[model samples]
Target: MREITGKQITDAIKKLVIEANYKLDDALIKKFKESIEKEKSETGKRILEQIIENAEIAKDGVYPLCQDTGASVIFAYVGEEIVFKENGNGESILVSAINKGVSESYVEGYLRKSIVRDPFDRVNTKNNTPAMIVTEIVTGDKMKLVYMTKGGGCENMSLLKVLAPAAGLEGVKQFVVDTVENAHANPCPPVFVGVGVGGDFEKCAYLAKKALMRGINEKNPNPFYAEMEEDLLERINKTGVGPQGFGGTITAIAVHVEAFPCHIASLPVAVNIDCHSHRHKEIIL
Candidate 1:
């Protein structure tokens, strides 16, 4: 087994958190550029241009792409063949590393501290950590870490439901499209919609969040889901919610769907909305 040091993980997460907050993903940038061209509304086109310009400026580190630096949402895939060495303090090395990175990155980057210490208390965490961390064991020798700055606006607009098995495909499609239409511009316009279908309630929600990690330019690997994604994208854009919701042709940039096997009677569907920033970064170690 390859031994991974806690310090190494800490440093890596810190780097990724800061960089992702400042620089928008290249794939997402490309989508914005393309969206600008396809946008029929003059106002929408102008908004798209400003978005591109903001990305360019943020890339230089002068400021983050959005005022909301976001919560540190981490997805760590620990390979079966790898072992994370414990830190000296006896805490879980992985958790320590992640939180340390999150804390340092937020302070150093001057990003906003948006996380509260408790739901009821409503006190600021001050450091923007500890992260909302998720881990999965996967077949591989390399540890892959995906860091996403999930903005509150878009995250708050996410939706889910446990549909009857009979609801099936049409139900899911209509639900997703309706969610976007209802959201209007709350989550920001030209959003990427991640849909999770078929899994149990919680699993479906996780799948929906994870689906946002996929590149906007890529489609679902399964032909059925791929078609569904395309259909949803078209239908959502047809809403004319436009850029920043002022009204235009390209409301949503893309739709991504991830599916899992479910029990016969249950069909759980989730929609995780991501704003135009699409702040996510990945690294393998």
Candidate 2:
């Protein structure tokens, strides 16, 4: 079995956090540039241009692309054939490494600390420790980690609902469009919509978040869902929310849907909205 050390994990996570903060993914940048040509509004064109410039500036690493550096959420896939070498630290090796990385990146990288210790008290976790880590055991020998910098503005606009199975496909469409339209301009328009159409309550939400990790240029593998994604994209853009909600031809850059099996009586749907800057990076070890 391959031995993976805590030190390696810690260093990798730290670099990822800092690097992800400063750099916008190239695929997303391509979409932003393309959207500029399709945008009809003069104001929208200007907005897209400024966005492109901001991305270029951010690539220089002077500051993060967004003021909200966002919550450090780690999606970990552990391999069955590898052994995680433990340190003397009592914490789970992976958890400890992730926390250390977050703390170091937020402090040393000068990223913003937005996490609070309590919902009511509203005290900041100045060090940005205790990052949210989600792990799963996968059938492979290589471990993988995906670090997502999820900003609050778009996160707040996300929605989850338990619909009756009878609600059907049309209902899913309406709910998703309504959720985006209701947000108006808050989530920072030209959003990427991730829709989870099945699974149970909590799983449905997870599916939605995972869906956003997909590249915007990709499509759902299932032909039905691929078509659904296309229709949803067309409808959401029709909302006229446009770039930064200034009314344009492109309200959303993409719509990705990930679905799983669910209980017979329940149809759970979740929508995770990501602003124009949908950021994430993956590392295979």
Candidate 3:
């Protein structure tokens, strides 16, 4: 069995959190360029252009792409064949190491500390500790970490609905489009939408967030869902929310849909939105 040390995990997380905040994903950059060409509104085109420029400046790592450095979100795929060494502390070594890395990255990298100690008390966490980590066990000996700096603005606009199973596919489409329409500039226009269909309430929300992890250009492997993604993208852009909701031809860069089996009696749907920044990255260790 392969043995992975806590230090190794800490170092990896630190690098990933820093890198994701500084450099926008290549796929998203390409999409922005394409959208700039397609945008009919002069103001919308200018907004997209400025967004691209901001990304370029942040690539130097001296500054972040947005003021809201965002909460640290991690999806960890741990290989069953790999053994993680304990740190001798009572706490879980893996979780401790991950949080340590996150704290160091935010503090040392000069990223803003946006996390709070409690939802209501609103005291700042200072170092952005206790990252939102979701771990899954997989077959190989290597560990994979998918990281995203999820800003609050877009996250706040996400929604979930437990539609009647009778609501069906059309119902799902309507909910997603209406959610975007209701959000408008609040979620940051030209958003990237992630839709989760089926599953229970919580699982549906998770699925929607995972859908955002897919590459901007990547289509769902299942052709049925892939077609649905395309249809939703078209309908969303047609909302005329435009870039930053200024009114334009492209309101959304892409719509990604993920689905799972659910009880016959329930149809749970969720929508997770990400603003233009769309900061995310993946690494294997």
Candidate 4:
């Protein structure tokens, strides 16, 4: 069995937090450039150009792309064969590491500390502690970590609906298109649409969020789903919501879907939207 220290995890998490917020992923940048070229509406093209410039400024200035640095969400895949040693305190080593990472990154990166400790009192944590962690045990020996800084605007726009089994593919398509159209400029246009279908309600939400981590230009492997993605994008852009909802042709950059089996009577669907500044990173150790 492989033994991994908590400090290593903490260090890696800190690095990922800094890097992800500062650097725009190449795939996302490339998609923005392509969108600029293909955008027919002059207003849409101008907005796309500004998006590209914003990314460049964030990278050069080593600043966050958006003011809402977002709550730190960490997804960990720990191998069953690996053992994690707990520190002297009873606190979970994993949780401690994540907190350490969040604290260091928020300070060093100059990210806004948006997390509040009490909903009633609205007390600020000051350092952005208590990261939202989701852990899974797998068969492999290596640990994989994905850091997702999910902003409130797009996250609040997420929606879920339980459709009758008979609703099938057509229902799913309508729901997705309708959700985007209703969102309008709220979620920040030129958004990435993440659709999760067929799972239980909660599972569907998880899958939808996971879909946001996929590379921007990468097509879904399943041809049927890929076609659905294409169709959904076409319909969403037809709304003319354009960049930042200023009115244009490029409403969304990509539509990514993840699916799973569900009960015979139910078809649960979830839609998670990521804004133009979609930010996430993965690390394997």
Between prediction 1 and prediction 4, which has the larger lDDT?
A: 1
lDDT of 2 by residue, 1-285 (tens): 789988788888888898788888888888888999998999999998888899899999996889988988899999998888868768788899888888988999999999999989989999776898889899878889889888999999999999999999999999999999998899988899999999999899998988898877889999999999999999998888898988988889999999999999999999999988777888898
lDDT assessment of candidate 1: 0.91
Q: What is the TM-score of each candidate against the true structure?
A: 0.98, 0.98, 0.98, 0.96
lDDT of 1 by residue, 191-252 (tens): 98999998898999999999999876788989999999999999998898999999999899
Please identify model 2 stretches exceeding 4 Å from their true place.
Answer: none
For candidate 4, lDDT tens digit of each residue in 174-237? 9998898889899888899999998898899988988888877777899998999899899988
| Per-residue lDDT of 282 in model 1 | 88
Question: Which candidate leads in lDDT?
Answer: 3
Report the candidate with higher lDDT, 2 versus 3.
3
TM-score of 1: 0.98
After superposing candidate 1, which stretches have Cα over 4 Å from the reference?
Answer: none
Off by over 4 Å in 3: none
Prediction-by-prediction clash tally: 0, 0, 0, 0
The predicted structure with the larger lDDT, 1 or 3, is 3
Candidate 4: C-alpha RMSD to true structure equals 1.3
Residue 60 local lDDT, model 3: 92
